[model samples]
Target: MVRALVVGATRGLGASLTRQYASKASSTVFATTRSSVPKDFPENVKWLSGVDLQKPKVGDDLAGQLKGEKPLDLVIITAGRFTTEDFNDKGPNWDEEVTMYTTSSIAPVFLVHALFHAGLLSKGSKVVLVSSESGSITLRHESEGGGNYAHHASKAALNMVGRLLSLDLKDAGVVVSIIHPGFMRSDMTKGVGFDKFWDDGGAVTTDDAASSLVEWTEKLDISKTGEYWAPRGPGDIGTAEATLGKGLSTPLKLPWRWLLRKAISVILLRDTALVWSLLRFRTRTAIYDKTLFVKCGLPLAVPADQDAGDDAQADDPDGHATGDDETLAMG
Candidate 1:
């Protein structure tokens, strides 16, 4: 009787995740794509339209559906775009960066907002944001080969957005987690040379990613909200025993009364962006001041970190970001 909704269910990792849930027989899956649903999709799957990741309707449509149907047990955001270069800097192809960020990062957060607004996810509903370690600031420092800025920043933004959602929904017992799927062979990485990941060789399969995610998700405890995880480990990532006093344990200390206050703030409020800006500013200020060497009381701004608030505002002067596929032939 579990119900799941998957955005971008027509291809790649999204399709793989949808198949796993639909085939389980215990789930009623709603699969969405901008164009057509696959002919081979399972019988339990319902196909819907108007869920393009780049548009506001993506969240609105899914929220309407979830409000009308049974409450969603799990919602997965898998719509994404990738590029070898940061399209913004890679001139003549900047649309690629816009597309990547809109699909992979911005849209997923909006999807969560819609669900919250519609009251579609009951207490304890689970949400998954498919992120990548390529988005990890921790991992980027260790990358031997430099590049992939657009894809990397988009995923990192996705992670931060997940954290933001967790802050809003944690009190409702809703669990949100960001998952890092290891390198896989897919359209996103097409034409990229990797002899070891050749079709004939030992490459990670989409099915493997889906199965691993489900296995870990199934075993997750209620207390493990707002955590990032990989499929490579042994013990559960969200448990006190696993982390032994890390970030995952912080939420457990928040009083239940605080969650009540948050739920009220969410329901009675319309200033979502204002709330987000303030919270992000607070978090960034705390982290930057503590981590970076401050000179003249101002944190040193790195060239690569070029003022996101300014750039995002400048890039979308009209206040609406467009999708990469907007100009593509959907037919």
Candidate 2:
């Protein structure tokens, strides 16, 4: 039998996920809420009330509640708080930013640590951190402009936390998935004045998003752990076309690796002596490993061998200095 826990399960995607898991035969579902249990919440689903993610002791409270239960097969943290911000007179509210960060990023670390220490998360356990496309710097484009700093940055921090947790738990056979659950038509969105974009933004019902997430979770494994994904694809990502280009596919994976590549390219471009040393040592077996070049910072196509003649060719590819070689030599 599978045991699943859905944090922040009073409403929206969390509630839907809890109900979905509870509906499955031979599956036990647990849910956490900051307030008292809702009247119509699924009878089969166990509830942990007064579980506020903003509080420092939230993790300990959860661990205490599920102390002796079977190890959870799945743990989904969906507690999130978003507040709009801008450079106008209203500006960014300090309280809102702190709350957003605490709920979305800081709390999950403690919650996962508590679970791991309590033996609630064992081998083969799947931990899903619900992030947002707003977390993606690549996805942010001029089209959307700027605002909601706290909401966006908080999710970004959550993504980093998820990645670190994955590395820490990899040896334990735990899979941590960071995901941007699709934009949804819920009170959370409505509260943030995003309802205007609901029609144009391709926002779906929370239940629909939950269904896609549940299906995706069922298929998730160690091979793709620590990756950020959008189970409903780029349909709702407004900047997908402007930022990532068109002709995209479903289960849209965020391009974090692209950022790493760009960073490496910047480093190689900035460090002239490093590139020069690499070129000089190209012939040496110890230094000229093509795999190492690929992994490190060589974004350009590398020739098989750079003999004296090839070096001459590279230095003056068009039979001219091109200034690049002169700059490299000066370094």
Candidate 3:
């Protein structure tokens, strides 16, 4: 049987994802909620209510509860908080930024770590983190401008979290995916006053966005682990066309391969620096040789045509040329 766990399942995409999983007869779905009194969820779904991701005890409690359950077939952390910020606002909102970073990125580490240790995660398990395209530095364009520093930065940090987690889990045959779950016309967007741009933003209903995300997650495998993708594809990404151009596909490659490429780059740079230093050293040695000869007022060496014998000994009485050759060799 397929066992699925969806965290932060009270509303929005999380709720829809939970519903999708519950609809499958072969699946036993578990969901989480931060609320002590969350609106009732479906009867088929097991609810882990009061599972606040911001707190460590929450993970400990949840891990203990699921210890005897089947190694989770799937785990998706959908907890996220977005707060808009602009230069016009009264400085930066430190509290909101911390919430965004902790919930969206930092919490996942401890949660996953605890679950794995508790035997809730095993080989062939898939972990998904619902990040956003806004996290992508390459995807950002000047046309959209910038204001939500915490929102964007949190997602970026989450992407790194996913990458490192993927590396850690790969040897165990577990796959980790980071995804932009697509834009949705949900209360979260409305609360952020993004409804004004809803039409232009190509926002869809939460159900529709969640459907695509569910489908995308279904296709995940250990081989495709450690990737960033948009479940709904580039169609919904506002900056996709502007920044990435057309016809770009994602879930691309080994996330750590880029670091390998960078290491290769460093080697190349080191070789280049070494060559440059040697050239500089040689030039300096040549300059010093000329200066030394001039400063010492040493007589020029005998012409090549002037063969040695008694005359050569008389010309280099001080043996300065021999000492100069030794200096050049040392240099």
Candidate that would win on lDDT: 2
Tens-place lDDT per residue, model 1, 1-331, is 6688888888877889889988887788888878765688788789886678877677887777656676788888877777676325653347878888998888888888888778777687899888875665544333235667677788888878877788888888888878776556776656545434445433466777678777766766556666666664412222223222344331222121222333335543556666555445645652322111121122334344445444443224533233332112110
Q: The CA-based lDDT of model 2 is what?
A: 0.84
Cα lDDT tens digits for candidate 3, 35-145: 763555667898887788788677787887686888999999998998888877555699988999999998999889888888888998999998887887666668888
> Which 10-residue window in model 2 sums to the lowest lDDT?
322-331
Candidate 3: worst-modelled 10 consecutive residues by lDDT: 252-261
Clashes of each: 0, 0, 0
Name the better of 1 and 2 by lDDT: 2
Q: Superposing all C-alpha atoms, what RMSD in Å does each candidate have to the true structure?
A: 15.5, 8.4, 16.5
lDDT of 3 at 136: 79
Best by TM-score: 2
Computed on alpha carbons, the lDDT of every model, listed in order, comes to 0.65, 0.84, 0.75
